[model samples]
Target: MARPSEGAARGKPRKIVLVTGGGGGIGRAAAQALGTGGRHVVITDIDASAACETRRLVTASGGTADIVEANLEIAEETANVVEHAAAKGMLAGVVHCAAVFPQRTFARATITDFDQVMGLNFRAAFLLAKAAVPVMEVKGGALVLLTSGAVRLEGADTPFQRPFALYGASKAALDRWALGVAPELRDRGIALHTLTPGAFVETPGTRRIDRRAIPSLPIVPARQVGEAIAWLARNPRMSLAGRRLDATAFGHTWGPG
Candidate 1:
C-alpha cells in the first residue's frame, strides 16, 4: 500500500472523505483513521450527538472533520451531503458504513421490519452512491461499502438473534449493486468496492445483545478494519473494484505490527 503524505494539502485544499454512518463503531474508527491520514473527513449520521462526538474524536486526532446529521434513506439529506462534500473541491473518497441488521427471523419479521432493514442496508447504499458519484468525478475517487462476515460464515454461533437471512440477503444484494456500478463509475474515473469485516464487535450497535451470549469468535480488532479501509481509500487499485474483501485477507495484506 502507498503511504499518504503526513499533512493536509496546501493550495487546492486536502482531499475530502465523506463517511456515511460515521457516528459509531467501525464508522467512527474509519473516520478517525482517515483524518489522521491527512484527509478532510466528514462524519455524518442519523444521530446528531454521535456525529458531533465523532467529529471531536477526529479533530482530537489532529485531522480536520465536520459533522452532518442526516437520515441517509432520505434523498434530500443525501443530496445535501454530496453538495457539502463537493464544495470542498476534490472529494477523493467515500466510505459507506451505514447498515441495519435487526435480528428477527422471517417468521417473526414484519413487512415494515423487513422494509426498514432493506431500506437502510441496501437502498440507502444505492442512494448514497448516487450522491457520491458526481463529486468523485472531479478527478477519481474510491468507494468502500462496509459489509459483514456473517453473510459468508452463516453457521457461526452468536446469539445476537441471527438476522442471518436478512443480513445475508442484503449483503449479497449490496455486493451485486457494487459490481453493477463499478463499470459505470470506472468510466468516470472512480473505483468502487466492498469491504467485509467479519468478527464479533462490541459496539453500541451490537451492545443491544446479551453480553453473556456474545460468542467467543476469533475476532479481528475493529481498529484493524478501520486501518485497512483507510489504506484502501488512498491506494486507488482498479483490481479492487467489484470485489468483496474480508478482514483476514486485508489483515494479511496491510495489518500493522
Candidate 2:
C-alpha cells in the first residue's frame, strides 16, 4: 500500500486518517466515512472490542481499516497512538472524538469529577496536537476536533441548565483552544477546524444523560457529521479551516470519496 502523501503527491487518491475514540458514535462513523478504498483508517479507542468492531465494519464496507487499542487520557499514550499510525503511513488527518461528559451539576459533582472531565475532554486535545503537529508538518494534514453546541448556547439560567456546567465548561475550553491554534496550523499547511453536531446524537454518552428533565433538543444523525468530517479530511487545505462548522450547515451532501 502506498503512503498517503506519496500517492497524493502523485495525484492518486490516498490518505491515512486516524480516528480516536473509534469505539462508537461519531468516532466510529468518521472511521467508516474516511475508509475509502484509497484511504487507510486507523481506529483507536480505550474500548478494544469496539475499536475492533469499527475496523470490521469499515473493512466490510470495502474500505481499508486497522485497529489499535489506546487510552488517550494518558498524555504519553496519545503520542504513542499517533506514532503507531505514522509508522505505517504519512498521516493525512485526525478526527478526535474522545471525550467525557459527566452530566453533573456543580452542586452534585466533586473536584475530582471536574479534574477527570477536564483531563480527557480538554487536556487530551492539547497533548494530541503537540504530538501530531510535528508529523503533519512533514506533509500537511487536517485536525478535526469535536466541539459541542452546548458550549455555544449560554446565558439561560434554569433548573435544568445546571446539569451541564461540567460538560459545557470542558467543551468551551476546547473551542477556545481550537481558535487559538488555527493560525499556527495554517503556517505548516495543516488545516485546523472544529466540528459540532449542532444537535443531540443519541450515543453511548447521551444515552447516559438523564433525559427526562433535560428537555428535548434537536438531533442530527451521526452519519451526517461523520461524512462531513471525512469531507474535511479529504479536501484538507481546500476545505474551510479555522472555522467551527455545525453539522446542519456542513454535512448535507458529501458521500465518502
Each candidate's lDDT (Cα)? 0.77, 0.80
Question: Largest TM-score belongs to which candidate?
Answer: 2
Give lDDT for model 2.
Answer: 0.80
Question: Where is model 2 more than 4 Å wrong at Cα?
Answer: 1-14, 153-156, 251-257
Q: Write the residue-wise lDDT of candidate 2 on 100-199 in tens digits.
A: 8776766789999998888888888888888888988787989889988768566435555567788788988898998898988888888998888888
lDDT of 1 by residue, 190-234 (tens): 888888886776678876755455556566677777877887776
